[model samples]
Target: MPESATYALDTRGERMDALEQYFREAARELREPGLALDADPDAVHRFLHLPAVRLQQHMLTPARYARHDDVLPSFVPAEASCAEWILAAEWLAYGDPGMTLASPGPALSTVVLRALADEAQQDWFFGRTSDWPTWAFFALTEPEKGSAATELTARLDADPSGEGWVLSGEKMYIGNGAHARVGVVFCRRATGPWGIEAVMVDTGDPGFHAETLPIIGLRGARISRLRFDGMRIPPERVLGRHRPRSRRGLQGALQAMLWFRPSVAAFALGVGRAACDYVLEQRPALAGAGRAEVDGMIDRLNRLRRLLRDVAAEIDAGSPNTFRVSGVKMRAARLAEDATLLAARLLGPASLVEHPWLDKAYRDVRAFEFMEGTGNIHRRGVFQGLLRDDYFTSRDRDVRPGRVAEGVV
Candidate 1:
């Protein structure tokens, strides 16, 4: 049988094949530099000139704003779809999750911008990035509130000067926060959900302050803490002004999360694939239980990849199944942890000391749990979906009328 036949999910066609191959080649350059990046987060600057890094910097830019000479693969659509993003994310992350996160680009901010920002706000953002390689952040999580929108205390009050708005609060664990030239900050203007709002802020402002945190894994991401001390925001800078009050902040944040959850799952799958691949490559002749274990992991990884691709396609088709996306993320994260742990166990005690790449993979995979949302959070989402009968239908005659099969939910 052909290699593709081994995995039923390999049905994405020739275009996706070329895209995957491109990222696979790009992943090679990241392996060596990824170690250096782990040791010194700032080392990412040295590798920014790599083709993959440059591609990431502009991958999400709308075609009109994209440079005519941009060398993106012909498979990329005028407006890249979520499926496209997830496919690229998985393969590139398979190369190096840390480096993939480290490469400068709009990152999560692009999702929020597209969901909330008006035409002018987007122009200001894409224009700056088009001028040069730029990094942007999406600031929503807070030190105490932990991104619980209802509980967040960050305030965007009317300027005493009666001219604009004054942003005052702090955000924590924001990726690229320290180095970002521009970003979107979520804050509250009143008391309820509708009070929440997202605003565009330039880090160059005097009131904006950020510092990189010392994190154990995914160091190259440069996750940082940010404080806004009376940050000034012009009226036009407030996002979602043209939309209804109810759909401004929290809705946009949720929409962005929904769209990106598949990509997050893909990232986890990539790390897991890397770990499993390393183990098998190192022990090519392994047999018995160990070989069976690795083969089982490969099978599950293939299934998870298929699920991720389906979720991405669903999102792109405008029929996102929120619970399914969350479930995929939860399962993928667990598989990554399991895969890395299995790699370590099978490779023996000295494996980490001998193989730096496997060691990094172990550490890097842990951060995916905290990326979009924690496993507990996703579990709650899946549970909610179960309660609503979102996963099954009455048409499934095999399923009981009111009760799901054991372990089915």
Candidate 2:
């Protein structure tokens, strides 16, 4: 690696620390002010700017790794697993999910670019991107297409003149749709309706329009609609042109799953953690050893956190085992819901819509179920990967990979 490349990798870690401290301070302020239940933008930005969180954001922040030009350890040291990434997210997210959403584009994009893009493209995507903040979303969702990565309408037409590609169609429920300068947009290419390709789209160009949709939860976070009006692309941005047969296309799809589903769980974890803390803080008597339900919640959360950490370690080591990560996603989202509901139940009817934390957390938790391929989609991803072993029963098999679970428990 060049001196600049080495330095950038080193700086990424440093930034993570700095961003982490920033969140610590923000959390401190929230507690002191007794703020309006996660409704502060300044606080959200502070949380976004945390060292751990900011590094997470910058990785995929560009015209799209989106660091575009930097080199990362093909395998992270044993010390830095996916857990470190998700764990840090867990902490910051606990304070505010709205704030925490920004960190992921970096983690997911960096991992994918390093794994997919060619050295030249990867170098440009990473090394050249401005430290100036760029937000991106995995724009695979469509109004008609929910969890199917293969079902998005955003079509990519690759110009055969050895020139570029054109992406047409739109995406909905896109996080950071309005402000995102670039995106990891998935499209059904013109080769066939069956031909699917994931391309990076620049929102600055003509024919590209993104309008954020109004959402009930995570109101501070930008969620929008994207319409690609004959969006043009150059050969340089072709992310998967040299698609490696074994893991290239499939892995990228899995990578998208890896980032968001657990994130859904992470979002839930934040609410659950806050809810538990709220319950413990509000009722001082439960400090005793025999906190059965509280202990159970803690146990479930700890296990899920461990799963996140272990799987992240695998991804960092360049040895991604989606089965393990998918399990974590399953457990995380479910337990998070249970954890939050437990708190709500313990707090009673008035607490369901109560002030400060519970009510907002309850709403945020709902988005987790729908975001990032949804719980049912992940269940399929997990089952497929695990059932690759074939020891599992055929009866559990879903119609389209797996079932789309609805009506959050």
Candidate 3:
């Protein structure tokens, strides 16, 4: 039997329910402070430490390896399905955006390392470390460079003796940037198709610097701007093969994002779901246009959730389905933004002035649009996929190997 079929667990739903309760309880105890968002940096650090420990104890490591048939080891979520992962993420997002925000840094780091790093490197980085949970992050966005890898300005220059490499650059909007023990920093090498290379940087290194950047939402998150004046690391710190003939570095980054984008959508979905639930509870009080808007948002959110599940199924079955992934991500971002706005509108002045939850959720949901890719970028990707022949025709429509022209026939 295939590995996907082999690992199917009948107990997944029960397990998820228990996990959800644990998360909800944790969120209640660790509820975000309203008055001063980032007031206590020490407290915010303490808040994440215990939860990280608990997650490690529960074997909640974001990515794990499983046998892909006895011949290959695959980075499938060892404890749950991709769909279940999304469900859990949704609850986390709803319960506490701050905790939800903390998760992606480690998760994204795991995904990128699994896809790019060698077996030895992966073990050394992700394997059992100290008693405390080891936090890691992926640093791709730069101070000046936008999302485009080709525009990467981070410098990765080799040492003259070839013993190591020196890194000098700044990364922006990096989650856990200030707190993470380790991070994968994407930089441009003088050589390479795109001059793109990813190097693992130790945040504790003397030359590495991190300053927290306060944001409108997810205030508890330790997002920071990382500056590497002269960070140095051994050659092994560089992930993937160095030889041009065997290069797969950038491709690995793309593959990693394909695995992660759904979780991004789930984060957005959770915010939207929270809005939907709140509005539904208040539906009796609402009349006319308010009620109709709530009804419309509920319908829209339900369809978006189903679309997310379908994309997750394809991922679980080991097909990344880039087109569907991009489509769902694009749709989910818009839906979350719209639903949160509508919910706030339905709640009237109370949402903004009297209560901070929905207002906070509104700001948090906006992060999804820029997380994996902006909505406009994903829309373009989805459109391009639709234009591909194989997306609908099963084969290239423009040129066929053995078929004659339809008009000639």
Off by over 4 Å in 2: 1-55, 58-81, 102-107, 127-129, 158-162, 190-194, 243-250, 287-291, 381-409
For model 2, residues 1-409, the per-residue Cα lDDT tens digits are: 2223322344655645553444444444333222332454234445433343444554334333333333322212212335545655576567767656643343355556655678786655554334446555667778887757655566768666656887788888877777776667777754443366666666788888987666667765667888887788776786767874444544566676766555566657666777777788776677554257887788767756655655666666777666655666666777777877887777777886565467767777777767665667667866786558631224333424534221111
- The global C-alpha lDDT for each of the candidates, from Candidate 1 onward, is 0.82, 0.60, 0.66
lDDT of 1 at 284: 94
What ranking of all candidate models by TM-score puts the best one first? 1, 3, 2
Error of 2 at 309 (Å): 2.3
lDDT of 1 by residue, 1-409 (tens): 0123222333568667766777777677788888999999989889876766655666777766766444454444434678878877888788887888888777777778888888999998878766556888889899977867777789999999999999999999998899999988999999998999999998998899999999989998999999999999999999999999998998888887886677778989988999999998999998999999999999889978876777787788888888888888988889999999999999999988989999898899998898888999999988998798785334333757564432222
TM-score, each model?
Answer: 0.92, 0.75, 0.80
CA lDDT for candidate 2: 0.60
For residue 248, model 2's alpha carbon misses the true position, in angstroms, by 5.0
* Residue pairs in candidate 1 whose N, alpha carbon or C atoms collide under 3 angstroms: none
Which regions of candidate 3 are displaced past 4 Å?
1-42, 46-81, 103-105, 127-133, 191-194, 242-247, 282-284, 389-409
TM-score of 3: 0.80
> Which number leads on lDDT?
1
